[model samples]
Target chain A: MGGADIERLIALLARLPGLGPRSARRAALALLRQPQTRMLPLAQAMEQAARTVRTCSTCGNLDTHDPCGICTDSARDRGLVCVVETVGDLWALERAGVHRGVYQVLGGTLSALSGTGPDDLNLAPLLARLEEGGVREVILALGATVEGAATAHWLQDRLAGFDVPVSRVGQGVPMGGGALDVLDDGTLAAALTARKIYS
Target chain B: MGGADIERLIALLARLPGLGPRSARRAALALLRQPQTRMLPLAQAMEQAARTVRTCSTCGNLDTHDPCGICTDSARDRGLVCVVETVGDLWALERAGVHRGVYQVLGGTLSALSGTGPDDLNLAPLLARLEEGGVREVILALGATVEGAATAHWLQDRLAGFDVPVSRVGQGVPMGGGALDVLDDGTLAAALTARKIYS
Candidate 1:
């Protein structure tokens, strides 16, 4: 705390997610020990990101590009867009390699109790993107919670005349998971009812 | 993983103490959401610290000044000094508000197995500070562990010719810790032998 600049840096770092006062001290000390390797580079990166980063105009994902990398990637499937609740979810789906289509981040879900409505989300931009044509299907990859479901249902009602098919990700026991002993009864029951023929 | 700048920021942040890839994403999002309040300020703080913070030439604690604030404080006991193994230890002591004396960090301890020796530590500077005179007592406030004991012993031996009353902080059962039933035999025995009068 003796150095004003160091103390300021530690205090600022403490506000970052996952770091508290004690850990911020450790991080500050660590950064100080490797000024060239960690401190300078991290400061430069943060400044650069803060200066340039913007939300993707099409999908509401945080990126340096207005349209975002995924929205502009020519190789990605433009006819199928996956809708999600947040940028974290978009990143999760990207990390999983489960879908090749571009994504749409809702920013948040409709929470009736909390007074969040359709306009509160990034839904208008998504609709505008869809209206531009070429998209054939919309995948609702929202969470399985009440808010997520309500958002999906509302979006479905709004896009009723869009002439594009929309579907929620299928619900069942998770793949490579949900061993009978580990699964809850509702999941087990759903998986059993949705049982399909073996290929 | 979309925008190069955002991705690079996340990656660098992940390298910080207490942060991994997942938390880095969360931090990035948080910073992005409050660019003016958090991101720009934090980046500026880090840059300022990187440029100005330096090890105090007199005591080894980090500060912008050569002699450090603790060394310059007139009310603190100039004749008494607390010795520790690292800056974190110094901070811990400062936080406790127990000592009115200044501090000297050893930087590290002697370790035969790790090939660390006396010259590798901040011992020379400490000796020089003592040679400047008026260090009546040197408190070895290192840990009770073997490495701490070894460092303390080495310092005590080196300071024998100074005619200063060197002392290790008395240790036994920690306050509010190691209840009689919970304490190990070695701690219980030490606590018993070191017990003082009720007066």
Candidate 2:
């Protein structure tokens, strides 16, 4: 009756990304107050997610099935593939709606300082997919960071002997973001270099 | 294969306090990534909490029992009752570790604008508790807001005819709260009025 259950719930919630101890406690109390409306449903949903969610066999993307929706879909462009650093990056690209191709998750970029290498990532899977033919282009949609560059370079060298063209998604001024006054020097330079003529 | 289970879980989790859509998605992905370590236990705990936790009959406190642990505990000072506006307030007092007594939850304070009166609150249980026996004091630990003041005043008027003394918890500069420059005028005045001699 001292609410040990609530305390345990709070402790568990504290491990979530955006919540601290105080916010966890608040969330716990909120959940407890609306147990029927919120707590039970959330609990059930989480249980369902735990039971069903798994990594895609082909792309390393998290899904309920091995091939994943994107990898198995016939409507998507089989000739094009977008390579991303993480699942979050893949989701971001999906939300942007500019790319209609499938994705190959790198798991993470090569970071020499962190002792991460090509073998530690999903390079084998990408190479395997490319080797099967029909994919004419591989777009590197990785970040502009040092590790991202190193990984992209390694991938470029790996696919150099292959006939398929490997290119990077261009970096420039973001949509509705960073005006002239607010844009940093590096971003400004990149924007200028990658500037496209308005069609 | 699109992990609809995980997405649904994220949608449900986003409804919780302190978590938005973005963080909910991140949390869902994180939980999926470590099902055994995090997700399963949290789901089980929420299920447990939903099953067992209930509002105490003796005091409006929520706990696993009819009479909350605080209300039933003989170790606590039964003669002193701390009246609070909400369960969150009760938890806050518990966290503060200053109160050595049980609590009576008002559910909410009296609000003229919202048309909440004494009858709309949990005053019946409190009155019944007061009439039954050895309670020597009732402390109103409600906030210093308008509704709080009105509720306190109403309680004071009702308890005037009773044998037990009814008091309000003093307001001052909170512990580890407010620099002189940052303190609002009302708080500054309250702090000044409730000033204590330095030990």
Candidate 3:
């Protein structure tokens, strides 16, 4: 029955940022029933991704290689490093197009509540790389939450001995932002709470 | 530069459901920065799908063969046919696990407002299949709206002379359903306006 295949796909898709079982089912059905041209690319992409995707050994970014494309790109500014909590955060920063430096994906932010620490993150390797690679500056692009700031402070302290400039991406709404697509439930809730209703 | 490839991907992704330029850009950047697994699979899938996926000659459903798996399944009950407005609808019905017969996807519903008529849909071929094949019943699983009703009526009148049964799927809240996922603006607005509060 199509149920098994659908269930499997839905479970996999549910793990994606904005999707749940219902949405996953909707997406899977769309792929299954629509023109093959419209959906085959996505399926193939998913299939290939499942097979090959792994964490970058260098920057902790999701990649097929140990060192990601950014790490491997010779033209990129290796001296400048942009530090981010996760791959998602790194992607957001990249889309902004302001950063020309290579990234250091921490894999996760420091969180006492979640029991995440320096050892758990890929920061030591980043520090080792920094010592070897003449990195001049490190930019921290973290969330505005207390935990994010705490992590930033921790990171600054950890790199205190090193002679490198550390900066943080400014907090506020994304500058000159266009309409956001696919506002997932959490973002939607945040937006709703932020909204000022007309009289 | 990776910019052009990122832009091309963003354009394509922007057209997908729930993706704007920002999200598309983010997704594209994610792929670009970590291309080894992501890009390779996506490219492979795109190429393979383009080569292999085709429409079922009998039904409009996407398939590698002329007749889709449902149409060709020997164990399926061909005597009864469930007619749906879209292949997506057919998949929805299938997920509910209520229907046992095969399906006939209309591709779209009849809409006088939108100027969609017999020619615009795959209705003619459906009718032909009904007449030529040993089909005894047709179940209408279209939305319970004006266009859905009109289409159902049109089909009923067209096949009035034939000795067969025509029925509609149940309306109102679905079983195991709460707050339908990522509904269109119109449907979501309507649902919000029509929602009932329980004490």
Task: Highest lDDT: give the candidate number.
Answer: 2
Candidate number with the higher lDDT (1 or 2): 2
TM-score of 3: 0.64
lDDT of 2 by residue, A1-199 (tens): 3478877888999999888998888898899999999999999998888888888878778888888988888999978989999887888788778888888888899997888887899877778878888888999988988888889999999889778999998887878894687887877888899988999
Question: Which stretches of candidate 1 lie above 4 Å from their native place?
Answer: A112-115, A171-199, B176-199
Provide per-model DockQ scores: 0.71, 0.67, 0.14
Residue pairs in steric clash, candidate 3?
A: none
- Model 3 Cα lDDT, one tens digit per residue, B1-199: 1223344555664545545666655555556554665555454544444455555666666555558777888988888888888766766766677788788778888897899987887866667877786888888888768898799888888777677788766554444656677455656665576677997
Candidate 3, residue A188: the lDDT equals: 54
Which tens-of-lDDT digit does each residue in B113-182 have in candidate 2?
A: 9999888999888788788878899999999998998899999999887789998999878778857778
Q: Supply every candidate's count of residue pairs whose N, Cα or C atoms clash at under 3 angstroms.
A: 0, 0, 0
Q: In what order do the candidates fall by DockQ, top score first? A: 1, 2, 3
Ranking by lDDT: 2, 1, 3
Give the alpha carbon lDDT tens digit for every residue of A1-199 in model 3: 2333344544553443444567655655555554365566554544455445566777777665557777888988988888888777876666667788888888777888899876887797679977896899999887767678888999999887787888876543343555556435555555666666799
Residue A119 lDDT (model 1): 78
Better of 1 and 3 by lDDT: 1
Better of 1 and 2 by TM-score: 2
